[model samples]
Target: MISWQARALNLFLKQTVKRSIENTKDVNKLRFQMRALDKFVFGTSSNIERSQSMREGTLCDEIKLKFSNSKKKLLYVHGGAFVFKTPAIHNNFIARLAEPLDLHAIVPDYPLAPEYPFPAALDSCYVIYKSLLDAGTLPEDIIIAGDSAGGNIALSLLLRARRNGLPMPNCCVLISPVADMTQSGLSSVENRYSDALFSLDVMLYCRNLYLEGANHDLHNEEISPLFADFTGLPPFMFHAGSTELMRDDSTRLAEFMQAHGVETHLQVWREMPHVFPLFEQLPESKAALQQIVDFIKKQQN
Candidate 1:
């Protein structure tokens, strides 16, 4: 059963967030509006110390929970439909994870879509990962995570790393990932009305913008990841709402990974919003966050 808080939030999102996304036709305007809204609703974390550095010429941000002393690192890729930067909600979420897990989190402010599409984002993330390894951070001490479009990048980064013979991270966590860019998932149609945060049209709009100057098609494994080779990737934990338009993106990818002999844990919350864990007010969000912490801990052991 969905909590009252989640139910209420869903209704609120449908009337405001969902409608706003549907009505916004200009990508730049939408990005600015969403960033402002996210800041207003979910303010940045005060408990995390933030700093910036350049990785392979691309600016990257780092966040660490105050007093965290662990050597482990979290390579978090923030999601904004491949357009926007790391919003406050993601910063708060990372703080929650970093506090309990004692992790040093690295967030890459990769180039956005419509301006720097396709290989740009993917290549930036790859260089960041390579930099981490070169700096003597053991792969086993690292955790790669992302939400929505960032999840897509996280998975694609691993595939690229594997092809280049880089060691896999300890594990990966994907929150409501957009795994299938082709929009072939059944939930994309089945849960069209159930999902309060996204509509099919909005997803297509983002995809078009993201692929505007891309050389590859939507089916390219690097872009969709649903069609990629997962032969030797690390363990994965996937979370998605059952009512999400792209719920099957997580489900199908988890199933595929399991078939490829990779360990995977998939959690589908009933009637929750897309990337529901980002809404920290929900009790369900607390539980999901705990599960992610536990998953990372288990990987370490």
Candidate 2:
């Protein structure tokens, strides 16, 4: 059953997000609306102790916690539909997930779109991963993760690394990832009204902003990891709200990976909204985080 807090959040999104998207026609105006609402959406919780800083020119936050001398680390990318900036909630969830395992989450604030465009964010992420490997961080000890657009970036980063023959991460954890920028998934249309946080119009607007008049092919594997070869990639654990518009993105990517003999697991939470794992107050979210924790631990073993 969905928690009351989730339901209330749904209602709030219906009133604020849906209404704002419905009224705003221009992409810039929509982005403005989202930015205003993002303030409330990014509020920090009392439970997590996080501090932000700049590392290798990438904005990141370190969660204050002590763990054994394990060298396990995490690269958690934040999601904002390619335009919206990272908020405190991203840091909070990363801390919650990493603190328990003594995993250090390095969240890089990659470039946003409509300004930096498609390859900019991807390039930034790739460089960060490469830097980790260069700094003697074993690829097998690092966990690459992200949610929504960030999830998309996480997958693309692996694909880029694999194509260039770089070491792969130990595992990947994705929450409601936009695996396909083409937005061709059935759930994208079917779950429009069901997904409280996203809509077809809203996604298209974000897509256009990310593309930025570039002639890039949306179906390109780098743009959409759904089209990429998953062979030799690390194991993947995907979490998505059943009602989310991007639910099929997870399913499709899972099927593709499994078909290619890659280890993959997809967990669907009933009636939950996009990236429900961020709702640390909800029981379901806690359960979901535990699932990820177990997945990562299994990778370590």
Candidate 3:
């Protein structure tokens, strides 16, 4: 059941985020608008101390959560259609995730598309992961997680790491991830009108921008990891809103992973929107987050 608060927030997002996305065609302008929306929706906060650093020459932000113990780390990739910076919602979410488990979340602000394009963001993410390994964080003690496009990068990062013979993380948690960048999934067409946060137009725009320089098939496994082999990946938990256009993205990825004999959990929340866990006001959001925490705990054990 959808809580009243969740429903209300969904409506508000339809009004603000949906409308803004529909009217904005310029990529640069959309980036600015999304950043503003992030502020408006997430509110201003000074709770988390963020520091600047360079990873493989790309600027990244390390979120210093007040409750961090550094015993465990989460490499969180932010989702803004592959362009926008890590939003305040993600910062807050990291803090919440850190509070209970004393987790430290490292957010790498990878270069965006149309400017840096496909492999740039992916390469940057890999650099960050390699740096973590070099710094002595055992792969078993690290977890990789991302939302929306970040989830795309997270999955691709795992594949890339495996191909490079790097150790796998303990697990991965994808929140409304875009596993199939081709956007050919059933929900891509079915939930087009219902998903308030994303539209097919928006998806195409981001895809084109990200895939511009690849000069290869957009469905290439490196581009749309939904096409990749996942034989040896770690356990995964995918959370998606039932109303999300990316609902099938999560479902299909889970199915593929399970087919390969990997432990996969897919949680579909009814009436929720994309990345619903960012809305901590919604009870559904809290419940979904707890599910992630539980999955992480079980993996650790």
Cα RMSDs of all predictions? Answer: 1.6, 2.3, 2.0
TM match of model 3 to true structure? 0.94
Write candidate 3's Cα lDDT for 1-301 as tens digits: 6899988988987888787887456888787767776664454245566676776787766665564557688899989888676467787787677665557778887888889888889999988998889989999989999999999999999999999999999999999998887678889888988897877887788888888845668677778899999999999999998888999999999999999999999999898999999877888888988999999999998
Candidates ranked by TM-score, best first? 1, 3, 2
lDDT of 1 by residue, 120-234 (tens): 8989998999999999999999999999999999999999899999999999999999889888999989998888977888888888788884555888888899998799999
* Candidates 1 and 2, the one with greater lDDT: 1
List residue ranges in candidate 1 displaced over 4 A.
40-47, 213-215
The superposed Cα distance between candidate 1 and the true structure at residue 250, in angstroms, equals 0.4
Q: lDDT of each model, Cα atoms only?
A: 0.88, 0.84, 0.84
Q: Model 3: runs farther than 4 Å from truth?
A: 41-49, 64-69
TM-score of each: 0.95, 0.92, 0.94
- Model 2 C-alpha lDDT per residue in residues 1-301, reported as the tens digit of each score: 6789888888887788777786345767666766675555344435445667776677776663553455777888889888886465677688777667778778887888877998888888888889889999999889999999999999999999998989999999999998898888999888988888777887877888888967888888878889988999999999998888999999999999999999999999998888889867677888999999999989999
lDDT leaderboard ranking: 1, 3, 2
Q: CA shift at 50, candidate 1, in angstroms? A: 2.1
